[model samples]
Target: MLLLATGDVIAYSYAPGRPGFLSGAELLRALPPGAPGAPGTPGAIAVDVVAEDVMAEPSWDMSPSTMLELARRARSAILERGFDGVVITHGTDTLEETAYLVDLLAGRAAERGAIVLTGAVRSLDEPSSDGPRNLASSVVAAADGALRGAGAVVCVNDEVHAARWVAKVDATSVAAFSSAPFPVLGRVTGGRFERLSAPPPRPPVFAGDPASDVALIKTYPGIDPVLLTAVVDAGAQGVVLEGTGVGNVPVELFTTIAELTEWGIPVVVASRCRTSAAPLDEMRHGAGLATRVGAIGARGLAPSKARCALMVALGTGGIDAVRDWFRKL
Candidate 1:
């Protein structure tokens, strides 16, 4: 396993009252020789560690630039360094987002090897810390040949999820992530990967830094339209609206959506419901009305992932290009 540690709960102190007590390299070194990610064992997977201290911040502090950099490094490890697989230790807070970004960047090149991300819900000092076990499982999964071409995946709590569908559904549970409305790709058990499904292949979207000025809004009953205008006024390059079931928003926001389209700003409507895919023609008032007014339906994408996709689209091309990109989704 080629381990790239970007820091998070997994790298926190093993002793209470001591912050930054351990580096990712140190954590890997602590593993026994015959362990999943350790070296010097006759048949064990050899681990190569790369620790980027600059990116060693908490997941909430993660930014687009950092994510792009991580993607680049992971891509390099696979395409240039000749690694069969790359495993990343990321903060769980934004692990899904980073995993998706990596998947988008990796594109079809993912067929060459496996790219897996994992993190822990509890810090090392906490009782029953899940970091080591999760990391081991991720390493095991990455090294498995069956996962090649599986695209980027998040391996946590022994479950493997495709990057496109995984979401952090719990704040503190060890089993904090899920890929609802989509079955998990597989699982890691007894130090082996068991494949249950395969993820559909996707072409690479863009290779450059994503635009940072995108805005995401979740609508509620009687929500003010001023919120949309406020973001545009503040120079948001694009907007993703998390509407009610089936991507419905209040009829009051229709005019605003039209005006934004006229002004050349892209407005993508996605469902706020956990499992409902946003379908513009599903209703006449909210989703259909917004569609008629020029809002783009986000298809099956979650609001946050839609925002990431929009950012990548806007960075790569013009309004027409953004529309075409969403159309593929």
Candidate 2:
């Protein structure tokens, strides 16, 4: 019941080689010859699979909305293809963003089975290719039996992560893309799957408009309160603050946050470190300070993910409503 939504022939600003980039089709043709497997071979996991290419353009300047448009079409393709799960080959640059959008648009995440997103840090044409291994892992991960009922995830190399937490850590290493602050669900191995951590709760999410102006700001040492105060002044609908370890920020920033609360701008607090993450409702060091100061805990969400949640939540309703929605998601 798994489906593979393959990537388009898009090139990026950082792609290796020539003055420009090559198409995914062009790259695939350039790969070394390998022994092809028979259908449902004992050596392979017999995943109900399909390969649908998306994001054919090679530009790095796509917006979240444009990505959403592509995801929606891919989702439709998945449903039309009668797939219970999906895997996508996409540009690593926006893979995380696109994965989030696919989860949002699908709505039926559970019935859609495990949708895995994966791509190469190094392209296929390169001598040290990662695409074949990545694509194999993506296919295997997509049809993972234990992954049934789980939402979309990003599978690269041996590591598998929740789409909500997956981030690209190394630009050039074949072993790139790691899940921070959160644990990975599993890993692909020996044409089989192995579980690492429990699956996250993935409730169904309805699609919403994507043009909303939600922003993310990191709170660094000696960050002036004026910058945050100005963010509210600039009419930003909502802001997710990437705070320090365990969501801690300066108490003075809390005072500015109070001012922001009075102005009706929602500011969320998330930690800046990858190892230490934000807690949902519980007050840790930084989150408690912000909560005590009337700012909200981003609640188990990465700052970027929190920003996306805030944007969608605000578009659906006000801060109060958005807060409740975030809590449940």
Candidate 3:
């Protein structure tokens, strides 16, 4: 028999402005009849819905403070309310960012229960809407005991990916998210989660909320040095440079990067490419030169995630602390 586990699960929605969007009671009504939490189903999981208006702003409008609060609530649900898992319905635009933030916040508490994020590529009124199916799969993922200690994950199109590596790779396709250079952690098949690969262990969690004064800049041919200085002048406490291959940047920006670090502002270098780690040890070129002057490599993190890590590190400690955190990555 293909038996599915039954437990208490909470679903939080943060998507707004889609036509006839369903959440709360309406969302529960949409779950497939045999799935967990669906009305009239025997042995169904108990689900409580927190509507979008209550939990968050739209994904694009989300800030670090808002995301942190949501993470805290998810943790409380597992540790305090004794819930089996959590599911968040978010906007794809910033879904990866919020998911990653939650992963960071969950930290060691992640071992208690699963935290799964899901969203739709198409709205309810659109042809072949994916929201309801995604939500159902996400709830199942959350309820699965196999997912406990997996940290945060995003479940979409029946695929489960670790929050640390999942990214929004398509704008309009139902198959939108990807975790390239890393395989998915698992998949939802036959109404159950089948583990494919194990995720890496969780990093140390930050007790403080992330800082908002960090800036992310992308380097290009003939990139002006003033762009780096302007953000610092504008009160940016840290910066993540999306540099070229192997984290190289234009030599013209070298002096500005050096100056930022000298002034105690962190300058992290990340690759502009979609895959591979940014070791930044290309000593014969701009990347190595920047490292010599104090720039830190983002390792395997993309710029957006690097910015989140930098913000969290800065929120808790100073430049040396930030350097140490990245060093372990």
Report the alpha-carbon TM-score of model 2 versus the true structure. Answer: 0.78
Off by over 4 Å in 3: 1-20, 44-55, 282-287
For model 2, the superposed segments whose C-alpha errors exceed 4 Å read 1-61, 79-81, 180-183, 229-235, 274-281, 284-287
Flag clash pairs in model 1: none
How do the residues 161-274 of candidate 1 rate in per-residue lDDT, one tens digit apiece? Answer: 999999999999999999987999999887789999878557445655578788999998898999999999999999999987778788888899999989889999887776
Residue 93, model 1, lDDT: 90
- At residue 321, candidate 2 shows an lDDT of 62
Best candidate, TM-score-wise? 1
- On residues 108-220, what C-alpha lDDT tens digit does candidate 3 reach at each position? 56898899888888765556778778878887888888998989899999999999899999988999999988999999888788999999667665776578788999989
Candidate 2 residue pairs in clash (backbone atoms < 3 Å)? 3-85, 9-24, 10-58, 11-58, 247-286, 248-286, 280-299
How high a TM-score does candidate 1 get?
Answer: 0.91
Q: Is candidate 1 or candidate 3 better by lDDT?
A: 1
Task: Return whichever of 2 and 3 wins on lDDT.
Answer: 3
User: What would you estimate as the lDDT of candidate 3?
Assistant: 0.76
Q: Candidate 1, overall lDDT? A: 0.81
